[model samples]
Target chain A: MTSDATPALDPAVADRLKRDGNGLVAAIIQQHDTREVLMLGWMDDEALRRTLTEGRVTFWSRSRGEYWRKGDTSGNVQHVKGVALDCDGDALLVQVDQVGAACHTGSRTCFDGRDLPIVTDQSVTTDGDPAALEGDARG
Target chain B: MTSDATPALDPAVADRLKRDGNGLVAAIIQQHDTREVLMLGWMDDEALRRTLTEGRVTFWSRSRGEYWRKGDTSGNVQHVKGVALDCDGDALLVQVDQVGAACHTGSRTCFDGRDLPIVTDQSVTTDGDPAALEGDARG
Candidate 1:
């Protein structure tokens, strides 16, 4: 875990993370309150900068060669709670306060209907579908 | 997070979650030890059933119309620690003990090489990279 009050991340460490073997490090987004992981994406320097500067998570798209910020299009923005680096300084852990659904689907998170089911109210309901991002919403 | 012995989860809730308009939900995998999200995939009832029964996480591939068991091909499997459904029953939280690298790039986890630069031992090093996963020896 990273120290809460550090001047800034080491410039060298930042450089290394950007160059992980595949030219990118996959970002892991987790919920601050629940400690549940919400989504995963690729991140480059710009995305990391935007995430830190903007207080929202951003990722680099190797295919698009662009920055993909959470909620840029969909309303599912992931708020940054904290950031940590592994002992090897080869990975990142982003604690976020996700707003709205983390997945493109209408569900509140991206991991909807994943490992287990949650009971809501008197009835039991499953999570929403994320495919909606490619469906009518885009249309 | 849901308890380890949560009475098998209600079927009605599972059915509702399985219907995310497209009969799939995004399954986000996070590292139980580091709390870093590793990857994102889709899941169906069968996938969920397999994961629950096998003690490893599995998902359905909407693009391929098949079941995807993480580390099936690479040997980097995600061991389940705990699974939780969000309050709305629209998302899931899976705590896992990840093995090897989660990203296809072959790094230890997906959050590697993500543009997080830091100084270590007076040298700058990157995080996860293609080289990290190129010849991962983990089995």
Candidate 2:
């Protein structure tokens, strides 16, 4: 169902989306100019429509059960440049001109190198897999 | 729970994840060296396990109700570099060394600038509210 606050979405584009049981699809947000990925959010029909129509990113908050415009509170808005549907139609790639930090922790991207452990040759090979062996040997 | 075939996952890391009602998390795949985002997928515990253990990206196929190793048939394998959990823990950022095209249609990214229409100033204001008017004025 489209949000009452937004205009109707493109029927062809909307029809292609494969929403999950929760009527939500994963929206991968990317910075338009640099193509750096910022974050991933959930978008229902209403959220998608609002985002497409309003020219800013809107997401369906799973916890709050509401439509959240990205910059409404945090002022870290994602000004949308383009929205693309993947071949599977289950996910979306949203290209946006991001302002400020997209991450809640003040990191530029959610995948910033902090919490992520770098995959080393030792970790994969120690587990006793021949494939890991090949991986180690490749290095 | 970690999969039997893979190495034991850190309990702290696993505990942080907020799985959906269907017990799945959104996994964003990116090219490791170049940092280009490729696609998004869904993963359950087993899928995560297989990805780490097998050194390739594996996702839970919702429609087929099975596990799929990317590039197993397509030859577009994603050799993992690292996996990071978002601060919220509901989403994942998987860094990998992508091989060939990440998209089924041979695009480097699932969201390759094909379907996305560039957002120009004209589209938003024609059918918008005062907020959209403000957005237009901001530009």
Candidate 3:
């Protein structure tokens, strides 16, 4: 739970993010040890700057139009371990030491709860591979 | 594989995605069976529509500013099996039966070949329990 500035991020690397149109890029949060993805958030220049300068994960809330640091309200803080820029530079893989539940609904991930329903439309009907379409497309 | 117009996605579900700022949402691609995150792409309304209608994953390329379908040129096609909308409606979890390497570098995922460098900053130092930091932030 180190809160000092300078986590596992390279300032030069963060600058390479493509934040052109909306001054934002998608930050994918993953659990440091398990590599399980917790959640995704949008980060602006200031948000990335703060995240690098301040260790704790900070995100640009689109709905609120403000900078919200993780764990400011909930104890679910994400202490960054390392930050990796995707080859495309448009997305980010943020490896973090997460604490508590990552989802606001008390789930471990934002992807839980909802089961992806299979569409019986042409796309699925065309594929007769019954084995590949399990567990929300698990094969 | 079913290359016809149908894929494993529901159009109505995609319609629920919120496309306010920049008219785009972060589309996170995940491997159907392996659960490995392949890549992240941006999807506008048109992109989402095409993905649902056509069955192949289509993304809005920010740099090129065009609708690019997966595997169109690279041969790395993401045959979508399922699509999930985040509770906030700002992000998407796209499960796909991917073909070939998802990354341009011939890697299975865009996050490969990088070790998450650890930082001795306050964030890591505050938490002394190494046991709790297992399972990608799991105790």
Best by TM-score: 2
Off by over 4 Å in 2: A1-6, A113-121, A124-139, B1-8, B118-121, B124-139
Model 2 chain A: ten consecutive residues of lowest lDDT: A130-139
Please provide, for model 1 over B1-139, each residue's C-alpha lDDT reduced to its tens digit, 9 standing for 90 to 100: 7776735534754755623555654465666666666655556666665555556787876547787777889998787655654433434556677888877778765544453322222323234443322221111
lDDT tens per residue, model 2, A1-139: 7566636666766788888898999998988668777888999877887777667888999899988877787899998766777888888887788999998888898756434332344563332233443343212
What is candidate 1's lDDT per residue for A52-105, written digit by digit as tens?
555667788655677787787887777665555543343457767788877766
TM-score of model 2 (CA atoms) = 0.80
Error (Å) of candidate 2 at residue A69 is 1.3
Ordered from best to worst lDDT, the candidate numbers read: 2, 3, 1
lDDT of 2 at B78: 85
Model 1 CA lDDT for position B112? 48
Top candidate on lDDT is 2
lDDT of 3 by residue, B22-133 (tens): 7788888988777777889988877775665556788998778999987888888888776666777777777788999988888888867543333333333112343322
Better of 1 and 3 by lDDT: 3
Quote the true-contact fraction of every model. 0.08, 0.34, 0.22
lDDT scores of the candidates, listed in order: 0.56, 0.74, 0.69
Per-residue lDDT for B128 in model 1?
A: 49
Which residue runs of candidate 3 sit more than 4 Å off their true CA positions? A1-11, A120-139, B1-15, B114-139
